[model samples]
Target: MPRMLLVTVLALLCSACSSGGDRYDPPGLREVTAANQCMEQCQRHFDSCMTSSSSVDSSDRCGAGVATQRDTRCDTIDNPDLRKRCQASADYCRNRLPALTCGENRSRCVSRCGG
Candidate 1:
């Protein structure tokens, strides 16, 4: 009778111990989306400035503004994947700013966060 009681108590304890495992919640969906949208808008403004204005100074100022916005927004993102995407887009824009002509070739500035 004691052996049976011991077995029942052990079973109950085992079941109770296994009931409260940790649950994981994946992050970065909403924040990443918002960051990407904001970066896109900044990119468009930079592109518009590059295309319409002949002043190199103005374009440089616009590029700096875009870079600042991108960095600020991406820094707020918690997920590494999403943050990398935002940084990549910002890097592309900053790197390409000097070479941008009057044309609208922004394929290189595209954000990879959607993936």
Candidate 2:
């Protein structure tokens, strides 16, 4: 099981590295679809993280916010309490994103406790 898990993990990493796309773009006309995709990806990643923390799963949980943070109009926080504040900011971004547009996305983000 562990060996299969390792192969799956490696394959995921390689695919992620190769499947490059314009991640910064808004949802275009299909905001809901785009948000759903984002939300699905986030959920899958978070679920994998819950099952496995021996690798980049920790980063996956938080990295799920990358899309949200990019979309939100937040200024970079100063270094007063850098780590916590930045994480909080990311959390907020994730919450505000996929709210009304994508119901599934919104629910998943909420359950993820990103807000």
Candidate 3:
């Protein structure tokens, strides 16, 4: 769907940027892959985290778990800004948690970012 397309587009853009090694390290390709994987993981887990009708109810959901996975998921992305970057995706999942059923987390995230 549109969410996948947005992810694909963002991935393509990242790939293009990573290919231009003039700015990144020679091993930056692996880093890009890892970062992408981590983001995907975060998104997935975020969806999982909001399984309840009220995800904001911290007792059932744990932000730390998602934050941990994202922060340590990628070794290449050593910017130490995973929290900041993940916020958009996390916010997307958070806002959508009110749904009675599981919904499109990616679309939520993408839309949250104005995609």
Q: For model 3, state the Cα shift of residue 40 in Å.
A: 0.7
lDDT of 2 by residue, 1-54 (tens): 999999999999999989976668644667666666676777676565444543
Steric collisions counted per model: 0, 0, 0
Off by over 4 Å in 3: 1-27, 53-115
Please, what is the TM-score per model?
Answer: 0.35, 0.24, 0.26
Best by lDDT: 1
Clashes of 2: 0
Task: Give the best candidate by TM-score.
Answer: 1
Would you give me the overall lDDT of model 2?
0.56
Candidates 2 and 3 compared: the better one by TM-score is 3
Candidate 1's TM-score reads 0.35
Q: Alpha-carbon error at 93 in model 1, in Å?
A: 0.7
Candidate 1 residue 41 Cα shift, in angstroms, is 28
Instruction: Determine the backbone clash count of candidate 1.
Output: 0
Instruction: Give the Cα lDDT of each candidate.
Output: 0.68, 0.56, 0.56
